[model samples]
Target: MTFAAQVAMFSKLAEEKGMVNSLEGNLSVIDRQTGNIYITPSHRAKCLLTEEEICIVNPQGEQIGGTGKKSSEFFLHEAAYKARPDVGAVVHCHTPYLSAYAFAYRDFETPKDTFLSQIFGNIKCLPYGAHGTHEIHQGIEEALDGRPVALLGGHGVVCVGEDLEDAIGIMEAAENYAKTIAIKHKLF
Candidate 1:
């Protein structure tokens, strides 16, 4: 898919899944051919977003193109790319189910459900850090290891993948597992 289309797809996913508020969360993908990153704009409602609003950044985290402002948590995406050279896409979602685990400073215990196990082997929670800061980026990268998904303590969830679809799928899996865990916690 076109880079703009990819950005729009995941941005809509974030909204459709109720993973973000009006201006929350963000998604990004790196164009391997050009080494340029296309990301969602900060403070823009994903459902109403257009392709032109997606921001572009270089490998060095410098904004190189696009008219919209990069997401405020752009550093988080940058850190993921820097730490995992193989990661071509990153998604940060404020999905309530997953954010509950983070807000409670708890790890998302990998669910034993067959589907969850297959999707997220061990999505751990990162140590606490304030949002929009370098510390948050460091904590996320450290917790990420080589995994596709991790939680930002007291903040939200982050997922990295080979592309926008994979990243959004990871986020969806994280939310489902979080839902199962929440149910388990409530009943037991």
Candidate 2:
């Protein structure tokens, strides 16, 4: 599948799974060979995203292809790529369970022996960085130094992987892990 198509497919799946809402999330994958980034558009609903609507930006954040405007949070994705060359895709999700920790400014201190730890390895919540501004994405590289996921302080969650499938897998796993923790605290 094309890179744009892959992003659109995962964006819709993210919406269906409640990892992202109609207009609150973004997904992107880079063409490692060409350095082109296929990303979701700004102000559009992920549930209804189309491959044609996916925007393409060069490594320097210039619009190189596609018809739609790139997401405002593009810096966040750029930072991840710069920090981890091994990552090919990035997903920004506003998932409920995961956002709970972000909103509370708390980190996910998963036990080292747990399955979630294997996936997230203790998610960190970075300090508040206003969305759409450079400040918001600052320190992201350091936070993701050796982790696949991190909670955006007072914002949402960011997950990365070798591709869209891997990125979203980390995202879904993190959400489910967060949900389990919430339920455990409530009932126990």
Per-residue lDDT over 1-188 for candidate 2, one digit per residue giving the tens place of the 0 to 100 score? 99999998998898888777667889999888988889999888888888898999997779987778999899888888888899999999788888888999998888779767876788899989988887777678777989999899999999899998899888898888888988999999
lDDT of 1 by residue, 52-110 (tens): 88898887778887778888888888888877788889989878887888888787667
lDDT of each: 0.81, 0.87
**Candidate number achieving the greatest lDDT relative to the actual structure:** 2
Task: Please list the residue runs of candidate 1 whose C-alpha ends up more than 4 Å from where it truly belongs after superposition.
Answer: 111-115
Candidate 2 displacement at residue 170 in angstroms: 1.0
In order of appearance, the predictions have TM-scores of 0.90, 0.95
Q: Which regions of candidate 2 are displaced past 4 Å? A: none
